[model samples]
Target chain A: MDEFYHLIDWALCLSGLIGLWFFFSRTGGPLNKAQAYMSVFREKGIYNPSYGLAIAFVYALLDIALSIVIYVWFYNDYWTDSDFGIAHLGRVILLYTIVLVSLHVFLPKIDNRHLRKTINTVDYHKMGLSMAAFVVVCVAVEYWLKRFVYGMWYGEESESILATVAVVASTAWIASSVYTSLNRYESIKNASERTLGALKTRHAPIVFLRSFVLDKPQRKGMTFDEYICSTFALNSQPIVSLSDPDDFLPTGGSIKIQSTDEEWESAINTLLMECRAVVIFEGKTVSLKTEMAKIQRFHIPHDKVFVATPPQNYRLAAWNDGKITERKYTLNYIWNDFVKALDTYGGMHGLPETDPGECMIFSFDKHWNCKAPVKKTGKDFLGYVVDQTVVHENDKCDYISLAEKLNRFELQHTQVLSKSDEKRIEKAIIKALIMSALMSLAVILLIKLLVK
Target chain B: MTPTDFQTIEESLGSLFFILVLIYYFTQLGRLRHRKKLDDTDGVKKVKKQMLWGIPVFIVLFFAMVLSSSLLL
Candidate 1:
């Protein structure tokens, strides 16, 4: 038993090390799964109340099964002991059931609130203190419960109990993270689908074109597509994009059209003719340039297409020791390549010269006439600019500016949503939420009964 | 090797892992602070906020490991 315990400890330590390494190195894990699940939901039209409840129930059953397997494996000896086995298992299950219920009920609300606000320094400090207090409280409760409630019977085997709890809690935490990611994906998909349905009625769907790099989580943990969707969630038309050839799962923000390499050009041409607005994010790819040429050939109205220029460079002001110093970001190879490609294509000819160390998005009109570049100002959901001291002069063009420009155009053509359409979407979302909540409650009650 | 020797090696590895993790955490906090200062975007600020909790939890974990080792000894 001592040797087994030692082995388990070593395995845990090694696993922890590997998990940290994997987290830092990988980008596609839960996000990819969420995206894949969203794709399936869209294809199957499974966002209804009954479907949501079924999915939640399936996940809950899986969690219970996994937990049981782990518990029995760890306490195989204790199972035969009988006095402490079933009773202790019951308590652990009860604790986990509470956690699962709270996760389903509160996590979505917290995530929604997080999406709507700009976190500041005071908020960070408060969050830190709260987290510390929560941890302390959890530890205290566990210690008190073990000492006063079950410590007498399981006194010698406290270590095993603690280990089991740690394992169970870790598993539950991972499961909850996945669940939350999927829930967020579902919400985004729901909003996107609703917008698309509205736009289809008017034949004015927004078309989003970008280099594949924009799909990646660059310096920001979020993909540019996600940033755009969240920024314009309330007002903008549904944005759609061609799925990247290499992507296994469609990215979250834009509705992705799956097409073959040979079919993409024809697809883009068709979309360009029908789309109300075209958002072209600057990129260096040959396909993007080809698309640009096609846009020119199609003679798309200048007001209908918006070209988002990339930042030339960024200037970061940092405090080193006691003194403040300015540091200019070195031009990355990709940006340099992009500039050269744009220049060669004469796409940069009439555009305003971007200040050497600042980001701006320049809109163009018909005959390739350029508008004044939009500069970052005011606070939006992501707090575009919070501190005056540190300036992101070289950061990518602000999504808020792009969103504002698009929304301005969209509002000109916007018709107020009919009462029926509005009510239908709202009812669907509410029903799905209620069903999922009921399913969670049912799972918790079932677990409680089984444990008893 | 003897069991004591294995135990010593394990303890050393554990301590080293914690120390490395602590260094990484501090570095991340510094980068986030710099990003918050420079960009001050909500995303950066949110991540920096998360680090506030992250730092405490990691520190607590480190201390717990040390305490557990001492108790075992």
Candidate 2:
């Protein structure tokens, strides 16, 4: 019986880990999954409070049924002989059902309000710390209730400490998972809002055209579009793209413009004229090729178009004939094939001879001459410029310098804030800090009093 | 060593392991921030992979420790 219990516990732990991995593997992770669920609910017009309550009640019943099955299958004999019996199990299940129902009914409403307020920004680290503090308070309360109210100590000191540790670890994991999802959802929503705002204001948003494969999450669990959005958040121009019809939930990178197959060409042509810049990531797709043709046909100013190439000579391992074989490929090789397809288009330049192991962005002059490849330098500041006059073996300029150069070309202008505007922002930030500190103090005080 | 002594050592090791896991979590968080600064996508990937394995291992070890302690008591 002990061995069976241990096996079941370990199995549960393993299954939980697998579930976590599965959730993380999704494009936007669990938050996007939740958003997709909410989207569906909204589409059916069943996103209201009454529907939420009904759904939660149904789910709670299902959960209780599953619990009963597990209990009957595994613990029927053991629990019957022990202090904990069927009645105890039933009581526990009933309590859990109530808690689960409450969570399902209320969590979305709380999350929606939280997202609305923190749409532009959310400090995930702060959220995690806050959750940890909340868990600590709950642990303290549990300890107090056991010792004073019930007048009984835990079975052993080591057991109590271990239980606390387990609780803290689980709570930390849950908090981090929730905050990560919230942050991703918030970023996507904010990007979409900004994109629409830019279009309405005629801000000439940056149009992103790339192969759908690039939308896949990389090792860092970030899509290429998400990376671009993060990298250029300060650029004052929105990054927008035509929505992938296949994507059920909008991935939070560029603002996705929904259009059918028939409308794609017209949309691209419109974007070409309206966009401040068109950035295309290196990919080999018929749709991408067609888009490139449209760019050429429109004769969009050469300086306004940019090509982003991934790191060269990236290695990938493949299992062949019961042996692992590694192969290396460069984006320049792919770029050459793409250039070949557009034989008559002279505006775009061919990739450089050298393969810079880092991702590089290239632009052309108004006269269709290939300018120097731009890569993000290790340095953060603009002053770390290497002399472009000296021809380096690996020719590249800093991405910051390239942005500044583009600014010079008046492709997109950065807004300068006035002294009054700066002061107003500073005052608002100070006020927010004081309010947050006071709120934290109040929460601590409340927890202390409750524990007492 | 006697059985009690062995149990004492095991409990101490379990406590030490718990503390070490906590430290590991903090260090991983720091490493993630550093990776973000460098825009080191590959490094970020490595850290995430470590975390995925690290978390499950910690949970398993923790459960084993708890089970042993509970049985001893």
Candidate 3:
């Protein structure tokens, strides 16, 4: 029980190391995301200074929070025992204050051109070096803390031991940081290609079928469904959907039987959820192509999208020439070529589950709690989010189920929605405050009456 | 009302008042969740998930420790 505090202390110490990593190495890792976000707004004419300031402000506030949490339990010790713990708490407050002040005052003032150049680059070697520094710093601090505590128990001073250890560790970290900066590993290799190849070799598959629209009449007077049926002969398991344009009805019990226009967003979101690979007929309407772009933005590998910018890529028939299967002038031939491409680049047998650290097949929360699809024949724990259930003719459902529903009657009447229309911060704190006050009053009155 | 009477009532009803406020706030958060934009999905749900995971575990451990300490002694 006495030693439980040591665990908390050590955890906080490690957290400080993590916080420090997030602090200085704002070029890669978590801070890289913030910069990417800021870049978007920077194009929209937001002040460039705001980017660095935002990163530093977030870093400072998080560290200040970390410091407070680390020292809060010591308040009990101060009141019950002595002022020693309070002194340590004061030190924590001071440390966090210094960090906050330094970042808030200095980060924006860093030469803007240099910052811009540096921030966008992803230096994996720099990240590796930071990890090394964290290990070294934590090891030294833990050792010094142990020695100091042991010395205190034995009524002997160990400040010299602690100082020597800390200094050596910090110096080593500084050297490593400098080395990483000077000798950056410039391996521009696609890291995931090897992993994808491995999945192919293991027969983990990557096969896909999404909307195959032939809005223009099929060549040689063939119908869209007839052409689709011919393509499915190559792999009977893969069925091309002969969809109704108005079949954008959701698969759940939906009150709003949204028309085709109303269903577009939900339908596209569903495609992004289910289909990893997409094939859109080019030289046609831009709608399907737009859907393909959205999936690509969802970070489906580039090779997964096959658009026959026809006359160039349009095919009719294909021949398997031992090593390669060559295609002829047929639409099915284009699909055959695409299947081969998918087998090569995407994967042969497995679902398009991203390897660890790569973006998942479908995850809305890009910031956290991302789960990739499970590989070949394995189902991902993560599934599609359904907005409604209007049952398409093909019975091809992307929706898992409705998570919940909002009270539109009340929500529409609320004064302030989100900070911006685009931003969906759904919690209405002002209304919540009013409700809480009323509830509190009602409870107070009820309690008073009951007591009387 | 007299100051003494106010103080007496306040002391007795304070915990009840706070509990009701907590309930109201949680309910309102749940209600507001449905109003989220299509792309802005899982806004309040994420916070709810964290709280659901965190609070009960802490409460259980707290009560367990207190009971164990007294019982063992």
Candidate 4:
């Protein structure tokens, strides 16, 4: 026991000496440059492989020395001749391993982005297993120290309980640490993505699907409802419906369908003055190409006049020049292609470019119930259009953007909300308070349980 | 060992854990300053994660040690 104390004293002295040496060396010379490089490496989120590895090595040695001191200090002060022998140390080690293993298994599953990054795949599995192994090794070493270096804890009951307490407390600390880390990671990740995504989306174009009627519906033509639905589906717009023309139609707009070619031509002229784009759907009896050619005599650009026909499956050569097979019509694929074609003319800024650093984002928040408006730079406007659907179809609330919601949050400082909004925020706060209270109670109970 | 012995151990451990926590917080402060200097967020999450784990562990251990000593007494 005396010899162990001397060893620990020597180890501590050595650590202090090294620390002091580094402090002075780095404060006044070439070592400062090395430190600056290390700091840069850390800042870039790059693991200074050599430095981290070195730190880990030093930590391992320091930890072992500390553990030996802990064991020796406990043995000399408390455990004499009793049942609390090396075997008791083994049980304590096992308990520590169990708790660590539980954290390893559970912490990663909590689903927080900050925590996820910190506990990356390699770290998660490796650290958990290594910790368990470390516990076992610590126990073995404690046992060896007690058995050979000092004949202690052969039958000490009090020391046994004390040992148990130490192990239990340490394990509890580790588990709690994991939980806390996971939560912090989540909040940080969410805040960062929300801020950046909002900034990016702010400058992007606001795209709206505009529809105008062409030749007034002939008696054989599809109803406005069916036509609009099919067109929207063909265009692959995220908008699900505009079935109620009352909801979308421009106020004071007149509607009339011409049955004759003479009436249709006049209707087309009138509709052209009133709207931006017109759709002409020709029934199977009409030759769409002939009618389209006549319209083109007016010399409108071909891109604005979108034409659709019934699909027919046929064989075509594959890209690899292998045998071709008949393929079915896919509205999803066709609409994507249509969007691509529109992008070429509108300048392809209509698609969301994949952001490498930005993480999975929920476009709306529960509290604000608002969708985020898209922001984009002029470069983004030239390059890609980001389109996002904020609210789920099944959700009852209307979409609100994050920027708008942030504005709403700011509003709370001034005027009071409506009775219903007040009630909603109040309910949320109450729920949060209740959850926090419950968690506190659970933690208290767990501490009590683990102590026993 | 008497209850007081356990109490002493608990108190010392509490202080030790606090010291460890303080060390960690100082390290984090340095890191945050460095990070803010560079205007970056990359891998900051990892450091935050470690602090999250480390800070609470000290707190829990401090209380646990106190409670265990009382129970033992």
Relative to the real complex, the DockQ score for model 2 comes to 0.03
lDDT for A68 (candidate 4): 52
Off by over 4 Å in 1: A1-172, A188-205, A216-223, A231-240, A244-256, A274-276, A300-305, A309-331, A350-359, A364-372, A376-452, B1-73
Candidate 1 residue-wise lDDT, A53-163, digit = tens: 333333334434444443444333434445444444454344334433433433221100011111111223333343334334444444454445444235358865785
Cα lDDT tens digits for candidate 2, A106-177: 332211111121133444445435443543454455445434443333568986688667656754564465
Against the correct fold, how does model 2 do in TM-score?
Answer: 0.41
Of the two candidates 1 and 3, the one with more favorable TM-score, higher being better, is: 1
TM-score for candidate 1: 0.37
Highest DockQ against the true fold, candidate = 1
True contacts kept of each: 0.00, 0.00, 0.00, 0.00
Judged by lDDT against the true structure, how good is candidate 3? 0.33
- Regions more than 4 Å wrong, model 4: A1-58, A62-124, A143-156, A168-452, B1-73
Q: Give the per-residue Cα lDDT of candidate 2 at A96.
A: 37
| Poorest 10 consecutive residues by lDDT, candidate 4 chain A | A314-323
Clashes of each: 3, 0, 15, 23
Better of 1 and 3 by lDDT: 1
Candidate 2: pairs in clash: none
How far off is residue A178 in model 1, in Å? Answer: 1.5
* Per-residue accuracy of model 3 over A88-181 as CA lDDT, tens digit each: 3344344334433333332222111110111124455655465445435544543454245322222234755565666676557544643342
TM-score of 4: 0.20
B59: Cα error in model 2, Å: 37
lDDT of 4 by residue, A285-391 (tens): 12222333343445433223322221111011111011111022122222333334333332222232222111112122322121332332222311122222221
